[model samples]
Target: MSLANVFSIAGSGMSAQSIRLNATSSNIANAETVSSSIDETYRARYPVFAHAMNDAQEEGSLFEDQPKAVGAGVQVMGVVESQEALQARYDPNHPMANEEGYVYYPNVNVVEQMADMISASRSFQTNVDVLNTAKSMMQKVLTLGQ
Candidate 1:
């Protein structure tokens, strides 16, 4: 890919990582939230990404030659809620306790969320490095005649 395309690809990666960070942050924020009912509890949400591949397809199949199938970058497909069962706490005195003297907490795993945050942060940093390196490369290219 061209140095110019590097900028576009890195930018897209940065954007996708930003979305992932946001999702992780949201999940962390609601990790401890308690609810009286399952419907009211906050479910951990995650962002989905899809390869930004070109629409052109090979004859009779979605597959294409490597060069033609070069990914543009990535895009956030959507956010999906975790389907894991919620935690039920037997806190009879809690204000949000249900009729059965149980309060429902989100299924968010704090440790997992922390790991996700770290991964997203590193991915973002990597993309930033990519852009910076691309910029330096482009600058050097301009100096080839000097």
Candidate 2:
């Protein structure tokens, strides 16, 4: 594979990580939200990713065997909500309390959300590092031509 392809791969990784970080941030932001009903509570969201394999081969092109066309990257499939049950809090005096004197809270676990945030942040940093490394390697390659 050409050194140029490294940039493309790393760039895709960075983009995917950015999306993950955004979703994690959104989940954390809504973690403490309360609702009078389960339908109103915010559920935790997570980004799904898939491997973006080179599709040139599937396209059945004559140049399929070339490594230039084999570059793989990461793809964000979609965001999915957690299916965990909502937390039921007994708060007779709470404004959002239901007729049964119970308020519904999001099932978002604060600790887990924080951990996911950290992991996503770290993954983003790692992708940035990958891009930086690819850039340095590309620069070195250019120097060889000079």
Question: Top lDDT: which candidate number?
Answer: 1
TM-score of 2: 0.85
Candidate 1 root-mean-square deviation in Å: 3.8
State residue 137's C-alpha deviation in candidate 2, in Å. 1.3
Of candidate 1, the 10-residue stretch with the lowest lDDT total is: 55-64
Regions of model 1 farther than 4 Å from truth: 55-67
- TM, every model: 0.90, 0.85
Candidate number with greatest TM-score: 1
- The root-mean-square deviation over C-alpha atoms between each candidate and the true structure, in angstroms, is 3.8, 3.7
Per-residue C-alpha lDDT of model 2 across residues 72-131, encoded as one tens digit per residue: 789989999999998999998999888999888887888987888788788878878888
Each model's total of backbone clashes: 0, 0
Instruction: lDDT for model 1, please.
Output: 0.90
Candidate 2: where are CA atoms >4 Å away?
Answer: 56-71
